[model samples]
Target: MHDTGHNDVSPELDRRLMAAGLRLGRRNLGQTHPNPAVGALVVRHDSDGPIVVGRGWTAPGGRPHAETMALEQAGDAARGATIYTTLEPCAHDGKTPPCTDALIAAGPERVVMAIDDPDPRVSGKGRAALEAAGIVVTDGVLAKEAARDHAGHFSLVQKGRPHVTLKLAVSADGMIGRREGERMMITSKPALTAVQAMRSTSDAVVIGIGTVLIDDPRLTVRLPGLAGLSPLRVVLDPSGRLPLDSRLVTTADKVPVMAVVGPAAPANAKAALIESGVQVVETSDGPNGLNLHEALAALGEAGMTRVLVEGGARVAASLLSEDLLDEIVLFRAPVVVGPDGVRALEGYALSAIERSPRYRQIDAAIVGDDLMRRYWRD
Candidate 1:
């Protein structure tokens, strides 16, 4: 919240650099597991007056941190350069050396970070080390913006689980699909396209076995040029009822797929799914199916910091009832599927929502004929 460095650089310039760094950091977000996707920029002022010498984001798999890459690019230019970073440089040695050590070794004149590291191991130590080395550390340049930019990491550290989003599309009458496991499209092409883009951006997408049995969806990003960015596909199957010939099982070799089954799952079925390249996660069971707490823990262990649950109503209701959802994305369409349609809340539709965790609308937009609303847990 305070600027501690020298007064040579304008606040506007610092913000611009940090903003650019944040954008760069997000480019590889879903791929940077076990580490936050950080962005860094090295700026040097010459006759041109404050030109960026190097810029980099945290690489995939979290190796070669942002600062490491940027400093390497800056080389000798980093001696008197200023650094702008979205999050505090890590100060602890992890799979790689601490980023703060790299910054100190690089001999930057000043270091500006959007926010201090939330992890206790690094928290204030990064700034302390920089100030101790007389590096003119400018802390909290854009604290609020950076907190939002790094929310996935914050959630992972503070909550001990991934940031979970419950996404659903419902008819005007509040129906999700036709009854009897018949899949129905409630939204138009634009909404579907948006869903694909969202899937591409998240670390993984989850769905209940009910969804798989009913829809047989591929759950992959079909959009051209973006197919490669499709996130991991996770299906919650309590009794190991997932069909071996299902699209998810068949495509497990091409993309990552996890079948989260309950304790009572058949050993033969688990072995068969594993043989087909699907990761069989055996977790405890809940009313809807697999115990979501254990299921999410397994996901976080596997490096998913942000996950999307694209569900069949039962799963959505279960997440809401259990207070497991961190965010909600609802698409309200104009069409009605009538009384015979499936309710969005399974055995408990829109009624008794007062019993569920309250949510505050954070954003809303019109996607084709659907009204898309985003909410945060209140």
Candidate 2:
């Protein structure tokens, strides 16, 4: 519905080619959930003209990604065919095997890839393998849209954690808090619902001490028929400064983990939170308040591969400055906050900023007085 015509191209041909490409893309749905969705189409010219011979996409359980799935479906017909895929076929062996192997086995005459993977493991290895195998490969066709669709997957493949995008709604001119000391509800009900869905899909949800103090939000999935389907709640309290009466400490039966920034938590405070069923972990700070990168490494140790960060300005800015953020989800409400409140990102040298943060817009729609936009890092 949004204007996707920023590029010059025929709508009809784009639709058909995307359709052909999408046909092969569905095969990897099951395995690629937390990974960039991959789709591949095998085309062959016959007496009837150019016809799709096979197709495949990433499946669940994270195995047999697009290239592999397409090869499986294309089989013998894969030989002497052109393969159109959303990502450059993977070159490294992960989960099952390298996608490059499958493409070589299929013997496709040429490969048309929309985007190149930035993951260190497969950045150019996949393409290199195809080239060495004597297969023709053409890169950058419909790369922008494809990247948008698979932003999260690529970020994880590249950084080992889901991109962390912090979304907040404030009033006109930048006031998160009102005259009566009440926090304003800037996002609409529909936007909140969308965020709930986002929570459901993520492996974990994270917050800072500031948000915990102000909102005391439960940070759980609360959609229709999804009451208890919530992500793990992570708190970054360097000094174990969470209040004793905090809802997170009192209400969680799931043994929520608290990440603190130092040696052992205070004996009494630790006893109180631990008795309340929270896991207190002490970590060192890397100059920033909580030493975010170390926190992420600890998360990795805890088996969290993807994390969604929801927080105030300080936490978000820290993550961005350290290049620890993987993605960003922004909710633009009708009410504009002015200069008194906090800015989205703060305290970074503008001239030093490189690696221009790239995001693919996933959703843009109005709900009540709010406009929600979901984006993933590229």
Candidate 3:
């Protein structure tokens, strides 16, 4: 919400710029982990309309930021042009020079930004530097949309934890599976494809030991071109009970997998898991099992900004019980599973309806006869 100066700018133009930035930023979601994905666009005004001179998104691995790339494309023509970016330009020197310096040198007449960077080093300094250089700046344009686009980065900087999402597919009667140890395709093909797309955006996908034992899922993105963009696979096995021949362990050589264990886990079992190329980390234990908060803190320290929890009941219940869940994605099929089927949530029982956690529905859509509902914490 920082402002350098105000001008007679068109609101429609601001919306168009923000939308463009958002579209570009989403191109490299999984590739940029610790760093935020940003986009920049350069515009020049004419009698007819504003012409886009250059556009660029953050590069892979987070170096050579969007502002620098867009400015370089504009070159001498950048002078007197207006720059629109999804995030406030960086004001500090890190792996590269400060982006604020690049924008200043480019001599943009005005800069319109969606949201200010939450990093302390560049929060307000970027805007301050631009104003000092006699540039007009307008921030907080389409700010809410920008925040949703960069939720992972904002969560990491402000809350010191990864943005957590719980994903599950249930029947019409709210049953996760018809029987225990049964590998069933609960959702349709289109819903499965959508789930794969979600996996490609997350930094890591987590499951409990029960899921590992029952499903034996590879937990990789299998879409046409997104197979290589699979996220890191994480398993919460407090007692080190995960089998060495599990799919996650077998695929460790091709995809990264980590096992979170408790201090009291068997030494031989831990060593065997490590021998299978699975990285192991120990955390504190709670009455239910591994301390979920401590494990998430470890992941945050390791630079994980977002986590998708594809659960087997126990894991979802534990995260909800600890008040650690941030979002929920429910894929509801039209089929019905009777009383004998396994429920979607277990272990956490609410004593009263008033004590239940509240969430607001953000989106709902139909995917090949299945209903996909998205909700966020209220």
Candidate 4:
């Protein structure tokens, strides 16, 4: 904890408290559906210096919000203390009472928010309520970092689209796989594990029907002790041609699977997939195949905030061309796959990606023998 007095927080202390709150907010980032993960901290001052009274993150299922937990833990120590929250306290009631009311009742002397909530019902109302109750309010302390943590929720609420992450593993020469459309390991084990971690953080992992038919990809998180965190597997089988004996179907009972199909899909295929515990969603066909916009909208309606597009080039090109992708996670291997190999982003111009203004590189690192590059839309 950083030292500070009542109503006299320094910039350094503000960053430290806000950073701690943001870290706590990520405890359940991919697990909280229909609600953004939030973190809160309660701090008090004494002759010795400032001390942390309590801290809490949003609960797993969105009930019993962070403020409630922290306030309960703080007890009488909360009076005249400062509360640091990653996002503005929610003012609207859903499964629980308004958090602003709880904060007001706690008799906190000050409330600091990393960023205001974007939900219309709580955007500015939470701060307004705090001020109305005579509690000092601070806004936008490390707002950018808070927004990054809340990206999925914001995308769903503001754009009616789940945050899409496009993952591609290519060789040094930009080839994605070997000839004949076989499943190839472009990156080594560590990079594969990193990709699995990415899968664990998403609500769903998407792939085109071609990938299913050719690669028969399982698309599940293979990491030990974290298999339960594997995201829902989504395959775009517009023609309803997915193989029933595939690994995805065999494990549908263990992990959720959704097949997005076109309206013209054969009833028999759809029924068989449903019989195997697969959730079949029907939408119209786009210029490519499945209407991705409608498919993503349906997912957002299902309360999925984030989805990973682990593709077979075609789906990736479609999502990129249609401007649906929100982020990119690329793995580049050191070896070349030669001219006989499958190229990345088929049917899309490389220059479009090279010169695109909407996306900016956010991070790059070496994962074992492969290099990972991540980008975010501006």
Per residue, candidate 1 scores C-alpha lDDT tens digits across 1-378 of 666756677788888888898898988877787788889999996666788889989998888899899999999999988999988888898888888889999998889989988899999998898889998888777777677667778888887888888888889999898885546689999999999988877889999998898789899999999888889999999998889999999999999899999987999999999999999998876775578899988888887888989998888888877888888888999999998998898877664342345776778999999999887764
| CA shift of 341, model 1, Å | 2.1
How close is every model to the real structure, measured as TM-score? 0.92, 0.69, 0.95, 0.95
CA lDDT of 235 in candidate 4?
93
How close to the true structure is residue 312 of candidate 1, measured as C-alpha lDDT?
82
Query: Per-residue lDDT tens digits of candidate 4, residues 1-378?
Result: 212224666867888988998898887766777788899999886667679899988886676788888899999999999999988899988878899999999999999888888889998899999988988888888988888888888999899979999998989988788876546689999998888888887888999988888878888878988877788899988899889999999999999999999977899999999999999999887856688899999999988988999988889888998999898888989989898888788866544555579888888999999988888897
**What C-alpha root-mean-square deviation, in Å, does candidate 3 show against the real structure?**
2.2
Q: What is the lDDT of residue 102 in candidate 3?
A: 93
Tally clashing residue pairs in candidate 3.
0
Candidate 2 lDDT by residue in tens digits, 214-325: 8887887779886555666788886677786777777668535554545434667767777877777667655545667667766655545556787766677788777676
User: Looking at model 2, which ten-residue stretch has the lowest summed lDDT?
Assistant: 1-10
Off by over 4 Å in 4: 1-6, 349-351
Off by over 4 Å in 3: 1-3, 347-357
User: Stretches of candidate 1 above 4 Å error?
Assistant: 45-49, 180-182, 347-357
Task: List pairs with backbone clashes in candidate 3.
Answer: none
Total clashing residue pairs per candidate?
0, 34, 0, 0
lDDT of 1 at 377: 67
Task: Please report, as a residue range, the 10-residue window in candidate 4 with the lowest summed lDDT.
Answer: 1-10
**Model 2 residue 52 lDDT score:** 77
lDDT of 3 by residue, 198-267 (tens): 9998989999999898889999999997888899999999999989998899999999999999976899
